[model samples]
Target: MGLVTIAGMAESGDIPMREPLAYFLTWTTYGTWLPGDQRGWVEKPGRFREPNRNMEVANREQMTEPEFVLTSPQRALVELTIRDHCKFRQWSMHAVNCRTNHVHVVVTATGYSPDDVMKQFKSWCTRRLKEHASKPEAPARGPTKNPANSLPLTLRQKFWTRGGSKRIIFDQEGMENAITYTLDGQ
Candidate 1:
């Protein structure tokens, strides 16, 4: 019923700009490194602080210039992936970008939850990617990866890491901020 914005990152954050890496799906998450009681949105760790917490913001304008721009190939693959999946699912894209470490997409789905949309998108995209890829055969050693995660997983486990965080986009101002944040950095 409302617009959705989703973001995903490369596997273990190890994607390089030059190579086409396998598709891995992720939903929004607050930093998992926070304290146990601060795990989800109810805690909002980015804005919250403990008794002895300290914050830091370095001045980058006077520091060394940024060395890399997110590459064209990497950006294009992400863009195409989002577009293809959205089109396949009848979603409308308001804005999106495939940045170096993550991807952001804003869309409206007619008849689906954002979680359902993400699952289908990940399945189709991962299958298509494997179809077009050239990967080495499984190693002739013990205990191969289970084709997803190697660790023992629940049989009914899903692909995405967790439920995505969402905000209600009520007007033009929210839309503008969403677009700007997706295109540029935080």
Candidate 2:
């Protein structure tokens, strides 16, 4: 009998859903992409030719304010939070970048679903953001429900959309390509 050890290999029990060698995940904040975006848009199962005006209007109406944009400091906070979370989980983080509208991260975490990882990152980041914005010295940027309130107006708003792109990297080449895209393409 022979025993073998494989690098970056996940045990069978670790992954409940489809087991990917690694994951390249990306998600955007709510109201960032409207129905008739010049870059095109996706809603539901099928794709539409023209932007869904009704959908765009509904999305905007649901927002408490205008589109959600992350400030430089806020982006930094999110990126740091993600790095810290990955470190604590002992996951191999290839690359990560947080922009005003969206965030991208490439990581290898066996025994965990991509959705689980995304949720963890989003939840932790949101909590940290709320905490940071609630501080007494934090600068005020957006419209507030109550001027006396402790939390920032943006913090009270939705930070991310429902679902996002989660791609699986199955091989060394795929991992390298994903990492390059995350670090440079973003």
Candidate 3:
């Protein structure tokens, strides 16, 4: 059924007329933030799972390499990747900030889930990071982050955590908040 808005409702017959105004996506680099983080953690469906110290320890034990922290070049590459991809896809990017441990993005992309958006960002970023890592002149700017980890950046298995925070913003206010948070809150 086609959605009509005359009744001050956004759906009709359980079908939405359009997607949310924007998507607020946040994700961390691999191994940096464990499952049982003291700041809280999301399991699925945006619900917070109970914190468990044992779970955190178990997560740490499963690591094959040190946590991935974005170097200055890496961070810049990531943001550029996102911008390029978004431009190619004709998606609207409200804001994007890539930090050492995590990254935040606010965007409006039709016909795609927030999960897909995050995956695209992570995948492209990984590809770019690998390419950058292989360059002999690529400066290892953040050399102190994981100095003891034996694996070279180029050979690392993954660059990001499996899943991330994806919030659907339904209104203009929420979209503004997301953009502000992505641009300035980090």
Candidate 4:
């Protein structure tokens, strides 16, 4: 598979364009970054909003569970799984970095939509994490404390946010910038 076509509006009689070189993906853990964060937030593509303390407070108050942060081991697991999965899928993995609260990756998956690629990465990472976390040799981490209530978080609690950023890398420069940012800047 090669470059895909970005179809133009059919009713408007638009044509197709070449696909981008790769994708720069970023995702945060659940509850760590709220919608109206002081660091700024995105409502959609090209729709960024100024930081709103009120929005952030409201989002925090409505949380069903406490914010998740990755342990060093967990972060290593995530990063490794990303590379392995990309290799298994035959996707070119340009770069990947995992932080305590988020992850960044640049990859070129020839035939997959960015959303599908992000979803697959998130799904496999979660599965591998859970599998690694569930062993008799290691004591279970016990249960996570929910911020909204007294209930302990079950194993089924969500590990990632609902959606993540998937920016198309249009050229080598963009891909290089993303890779540098992921590997060094953040």
In order, what is each prediction's RMSD in angstroms?
14.2, 7.5, 5.3, 6.0
Number of backbone collisions per candidate: 0, 1, 0, 0
Off by over 4 Å in 3: 1-17, 141-150
Question: Which segments of model 4 are wrong by more than 4 Å?
Answer: 1-16, 143-156
Give the alpha carbon lDDT tens digit for every residue of 1-186 in model 3: 333222222221233455677777889998888888767687764357877889899998998777887777778999999999999999999999999889998888998977789899999998888887787787752243455434677778877899887776667877777777778776
All candidates: TM-score:
0.46, 0.77, 0.84, 0.83
Q: Candidate 4 on 59-139: residue-level lDDT in tens?
A: 999987677777777789899999999999999999999998899998999888788999999999988777776764432
- Give me the candidate number with maximum lDDT: 3
Candidate 1 per-residue lDDT, tens place, 25-133, comes to 2343112222222322222312344432222113223222222222344346547777887787667777776654335665666555445656665555444333322
What RMSD value applies to candidate 4? 6.0
**Higher-scoring candidate on TM-score, 2 or 3:** 3
Worst 10 residues of 4 by lDDT: 7-16
lDDT preference between candidates 1 and 4, better one? 4
Task: Identify the runs in model 2 with alpha carbons over 4 angstroms from their true place.
Answer: 1-19, 44-50, 140-157
> What is the descending TM-score order?
3, 4, 2, 1
Q: What is the lDDT of residue 43 in candidate 1?
A: 29
Model 3 scores a C-alpha lDDT of: 0.76
Top model number, TM-score: 3
| Higher-scoring candidate on TM-score, 1 or 4 | 4
